[model samples]
Target chain A: MDDEQQEKQHLANDGRQMTLIDQIIRNKVFNCRYWKEDCFGLTAVTLVDKACKLDCVGATYSGTGKPVPFLCLLMKLLQINPDKEIIIEFLKSKDYKYISALAMFYIRLTSKPKEAYPTIEQFYADFRKIRIRNLDGTFAIWHMDELAEKLLSEEIIFGISLPRFQKRWILEELGQLEPRKSVLEEELQNQEQEQVQVAEQQNQEKDQEQGQEQ
Target chain B: SDDGKQKLNDEDTLDETEYALWKIRELKRIKQFNDEKNKYEIEKAEIDRRRNLTDMQRIQEDFKLGSDKTKMEDKTKYV
Candidate 1:
């Protein structure tokens, strides 16, 4: 119960606990019903319960510009400033895509370039279909992989500005990061090798026919 | 027609700010990509131009690429 009095500090980004969400929207989130009711008294440890229950990922809706439960939970996670281990656990959660999505959003907001890229990049393999709540408050199907790629490549998503990170290629060129090998690279290489063998066999057959003609 | 235009304008001004931000970031990312690629191409051309340079000149050229002095020294050993 002592941890429940949790300081009302904002999320830290780039060495400052600044409002990562726009001030107007953050205020709207605070005033939203979901934020007041469900988001109350959530500590870093207890936030997972709410995170697991999230069904859709979105920021604010269009007409009224109302914050969704997903965004409210996101704000709560930001407020609590959970440990790296806890956030990693959320990212690793197998049963809930929303938990992982929430973690990705958290990472994109709080982490430095060195930490954020690899943390989100690994999830590019998660192709499970997930729902994204559009600005119009409509749910649309989005793949887990697309979200990961967007987190890495796009500077903004769901109406939040992700802290800029050095591009992966630049890091690789500077010898600071390794080139990412795609999961499909091995299969593509095998297909090319098989094609080469078939072409070589065809060439041999053509040569044998020419020799017999001579 | 004016009333319809007014409603359309209001709608665009509402949640379209986020979309506008996305578009700006997308354009900026594309520009950065082009700049990085062009820089790479230019560096490759320089390396190719110095294909017949002596070992000492090659080391100097690598240093001019603005990498760390320590890394340049280490690379000099292998060159």
Candidate 2:
């Protein structure tokens, strides 16, 4: 067969091995953390499983402690509601900048070409002004306009080559977006149709008044 | 009233010293835990990196060896 076919087979094998390793890692992580006093009572078994499968063994935690709960929370949100309305609402939140950043990043990953803009544009002004604690426990403010600009300008936002293998670990496991088209044009068309209808109704009323008066 | 004030002041001093001791112990325990955590993390990373390298090497070797690769044996084995 061709080199392309060989390459495709190689990739499939690579994916299969990766998942196998992922399952084993998940098993070890659960076995280790599940019995810890702090983690013993935690609920949401499915979310915890998803969180464990995330490759964070070597991740640098903040000064406070372990990695940010970004992955776990994102998993929980996706598991509970794939509609992403709750996550979108998180963007409007002024209280938690880190959570907002997670939401913004999620949008970057999930949004369709045109549907991205309006969903993200309003949050732009807010998040740029927001500050978040990094994984290293350092306080940092988001250059939100820079981030927005990056998302809008780039095609492959999460697939940057520098952090090669671990980029997948950093990003939330992608959840499907509900099918949506930009409704701006449709809304405008609807308004125009309503205006025409209102005009026709007004003319009819005027004609009736004239007939009655006559 | 003067005697009562003196007792209250003594109690305050004892409480302050006790709280200071608690803080010191707490800080020490936290530092030890973090040190242990960091050491465990380093160990885990080393183990993972080695495993990852082996996995990559094995995959590359398998690809290089090719699907048709098989052991040579006695002449009549396939027949």
Best candidate (score: TM-score): 1
Output the worst ten-in-a-row residue range by lDDT, candidate 1 chain A.
A2-11
- The best candidate by lDDT is 1
| CAPRI band for model 1 | incorrect
TM-score of every model versus the real structure: 0.70, 0.31
Show model 1 residue runs off by greater than 4 Å.
Answer: A1-15, B1-79
Per-residue lDDT over A49-162 for candidate 1, one digit per residue giving the tens place of the 0 to 100 score: 887777677898878788978888887777767778998988998888789999988888888777787888777555565767777766666666678878888888877777
- CA lDDT, every prediction? 0.72, 0.43
Model 2 superposed RMSD (Cα): 25.7
Instruction: Report per-candidate TM-score of chain A alone.
Output: 0.89, 0.38
- What candidate 2 gets wrong by more than 4 Å, as runs, is A1-66, A133-138, A153-214, B1-79
TM-score, candidate 1, chain B alone: 0.49
Q: Considering summed lDDT, which 10 consecutive residues are worst modelled in model 2 chain A?
A: A161-170
